[model samples]
Target: MTMTNTAPAPTVWATLQANDAPALIDFLVNTFGFIKTAAYADGDQVAHAQLDWPEGGGIMLGSYKPDQEWSRRPGTAGMYVVTADPDALYAKVRAAGADIFRPITDQDYGNREFGVRDPEGNLWSFGHYRGEPHP
Candidate 1:
């Protein structure tokens, strides 16, 4: 069965923990076109950060803290981002020297997509799929 939502705005966000939160934020903003909305940090460790995708939605991330109750392991996140122009974004990502694990191609599901790894080792897939319509 397929599930759908009719919410007016996005209420869910993808989150991750990075070994170097600041650098990761920079890479995401510069390489993937994510907008750096906010970041709270203490010295070299980031407490929180928000990066918004221009098309829609965003993500929250912070430094990897093993002792914290909500601690998450770094380099283990995999996110799929929806874009309107995967081909253009793919070219830009490649120009930035990002590690491309999958070349851009047309999928049988009717989406054009590609995959890349960030400097922090997080996997990111960009595509033109917007998902099914809300019911």
Candidate 2:
């Protein structure tokens, strides 16, 4: 017996906490080209925000409030994003003053990749690697 799936693969989403959400949003949009999808505020402070990538998927974020019951340390996330042009993205990220952790280079696994840190210090990596079973 054989089975066939018909639904599109679910997209993976990540969350980030920021010390200054508005500033972070500006950095993401201007430097990384992420589009602001939604942003909620509480008394002039961003309560929550959603930024979408043009290619697909996105990341959620919020300003950290010490009084909040649920909050994580800002700048403690490491994320990998797949892109069609790592070299071009790397150039943009570099020109935007992103702190590069690793220069763009080819991997033995057949990926061209680069790593950098966002303004808030979240580790971000971009690559052409699609991982396994993504053909």
Candidate 3:
């Protein structure tokens, strides 16, 4: 039997730790057009940052410090973002010199999507598919 909840879905957020948080912030903003909603820096390192998409959704980020237990391998998180216009976003990412991991294609799941790697090698994907509602 399938079980379903009627509660609203919780907002899901992702955080990435970059060696150069400030630079990463700039890169995300410049390349993906993410807006820095809030940022705190400790000198050259970004203590914490929150970047938001124009319509909705966002991600948290900070500088990677070996001292932190949460630090992961450099540039290893695979991220997916929803976009209103996958084609347009793909063009921007291409112009930004992103290394295309997967060229824009219509997925069997119905998403017109593409994937790329950021300057630090983190994988990111943008797609027009919004998954079907839970039953």
Candidate 4:
């Protein structure tokens, strides 16, 4: 054991709360191609769920409670997920229930990307790197 002066940015497992987490998780997996890695239910309905990203990260799903701030209101902002085919994934997400906020198009600065809003109003984005994405 030794001491070092270096630290990396925290990695987060983001979870969104919706009315029916099972349904929402299903949509993400069946439609957008996420894979279920873990899940738990409070009886028969999903209480907590996890989805594995095809590329690298992960997402969690849980039933929304009106008492929580993120649950009380719809989400307008969302973190983007990387995809090999952004255009195709965008179309798929739209077909499944996402509202297209911005059509897929190449940016002058870099990658081709699109914006969408989910059924519960959580913003979803799919994109890939042509160069770099701003952080």
> Which candidate leads the pack in TM-score?
1
For all candidates in order, the CA lDDT equals 0.93, 0.86, 0.87, 0.75
Q: How many collisions between residues are there in candidate 1?
A: 0
lDDT of 4 by residue, 1-135 (tens): 999646443288877777767777777788779989898988546767889886767787777677756564435438688888898887877777667888898988677999877667777777897345478
Q: Candidate 3 regions off by >4 Å?
A: 1-10
Point out where model 1 deviates above 4 Å.
1-7
Q: Give the TM-score of candidate 1.
A: 0.92
Q: For residues 42-112, what per-residue lDDT tens digits would candidate 3 score against the true structure? A: 79888889998875788999888888788876599998888999999899989888789999999987889
* Cα error, candidate 4, residue 134 (Å): 12
- Candidate 3, residue 16: the lDDT equals 94
Better of 2 and 3 by TM-score: 3
Q: Write the per-residue lDDT of candidate 2 for residues 1-135, one digit (tens) a residue.
A: 999666454376788888889999999899888899999988558888999876667898899877777787898999888889998999999998889999999998899999988888899889988679945
- Candidate 2 RMSD computed on C-alpha atoms after optimal superposition onto the true structure: 5.4
Superposing all C-alpha atoms, what RMSD in Å does each candidate have to the true structure? 5.7, 5.4, 6.4, 6.1
Per-residue lDDT of 36 in model 1: 90
Cα lDDT tens digits for candidate 1, 19-55: 8999999999999999998999998899999998988
Better of 1 and 4 by TM-score: 1
Kindly report which residue pairs in candidate 1 clash with one another. Answer: none
Error of 2 at 63 (Å): 0.3
Residue 45 of model 2 has an lDDT of: 80
Q: Order the candidates by TM-score, highest first.
A: 1, 3, 2, 4
TM-score of each: 0.92, 0.86, 0.87, 0.74
Q: Once all C-alphas are superposed, what RMSD does model 1 give against the true structure?
A: 5.7
